[model samples]
Target: MPYGEAMLTIARELVDKIVAHGRADHPDEACGVIAGPVGSDRPERFIPMENAERSPTFYRFDSMEQFRVWREMDDRDEEPVVIYHSHTATEAYPSRTDVSYASEPNAHYVLVSTASEDDVEFRSYRIVEGVITEEPVKIVEAYG
Candidate 1:
């Protein structure tokens, strides 16, 4: 499938999990990946990754940890369907750095904003060739 062709459907529980992680790591960005069976387009596994940068305005996955996680996903015949991170003080939108760092053209880039304190701003986008295109996100009860 192409990068911007399909609407991303994420389980509500998974959304909750992501939001919770964002809140837990408030003031610092939290990063993670959602792995699913290849070609499935259904995110099934939520693997919260450590923010190596640990900075409020930036996030970088730990090198060794990212390698291990990707290796594990490969071994399980899975791929990262969604690459997610939190925006501590900004809106739920990708920053210039985020666009430059996005290497997965086919993965949905989800950004959660914990800026509101009382509200969670969740949004998804597709970043390809440094261009960001917002996509619709459908929260479902479960993936079948």
Candidate 2:
């Protein structure tokens, strides 16, 4: 399925980060954020991080930052609206594990695929009650 515009931007940055991290670590997964308001036209921030997991092909984001930003956003009426992850050697689609572990039905799931050898492919999905659905995203210029 094709990703919406909003997701494409997030996916792009995520792919870049993943590839850079993959190269930097040679085998570990790199994690980060695709943060912004809910249903916004563009991503507001890209928070990159070291995949503390140190796995050759896995990513585990530190939630403290997520919580901290979420709380701050809540205070200002903005929110850390999406949880994005990169698939170092997989497609730009959610895996079964992603589906099983998903807890936010109201948020978007952006995936950046670093598997494309020549280029990165990014997409977005919405998981509700274990069912995954692709939504349309509009990639607007960066915004805060």
Candidate 3:
């Protein structure tokens, strides 16, 4: 099926994994991609990527690592269904740079905020042509 046709349903475990990665890199943004079978619209593989910039206010995938990951995904006939990152001191929303750098119009852009000491705000959006549209995220125990 085509992407963005339905609400994104992510496994709870995957959500935890993303949150854990964010917490682990607290004070600095964490970035990664979840790959799924091409056209599946299902995020099934959690692939944590190294943030080249390693800045709390910025994130950039390591060029070599990204190339390798993309090549692997291509070999597996998969694509990035979800592109995610963390915001250490900001809201779980895309920054202007994020929107500008968004090249995956078919991928869900997920943002996690580790700014709150008591709560973590996780949100998802579709950034197409520089337009950001918030989408509902349904967390499930598993995905079949």
Best by lDDT: 3
Q: Ten-residue segment with the worst summed lDDT in candidate 3?
A: 1-10
lDDT of each: 0.91, 0.61, 0.93
Off by over 4 Å in 2: 1-26, 38-42, 141-144
Model 1 pairs whose backbones collide: none
What TM-score should be assigned to candidate 3?
Answer: 0.96
State the displacement of the C-alpha of residue 81, model 2, in Å, after optimal TM-score superposition: 2.6
Model 2 TM-score, all chains together = 0.69
Question: lDDT-based ranking, best first?
Answer: 3, 1, 2
- Model 1 segments more than 4 A misplaced: 1-5
Using all chains and alpha carbons, the TM-scores for the candidates as numbered come to 0.96, 0.69, 0.96
Candidate 1 residue lDDT tens string, 17-117: 99999999989999999999987788899999999998999999999999999999999999999999999998999999999899987799999999997
Worst 10 residues of 2 by lDDT: 1-10
Residue by residue across 15-120, what tens digits does model 3's lDDT show? 9999999999999999999999988888999999999998999999999999999999999999999999999999999999999999998899999999998889
Candidate 2: deviation at residue 130, Å?
A: 0.8
- lDDT value, residue 98 of candidate 3: 95
Q: What TM-score quantifies how close candidate 1 is to the native fold?
A: 0.96
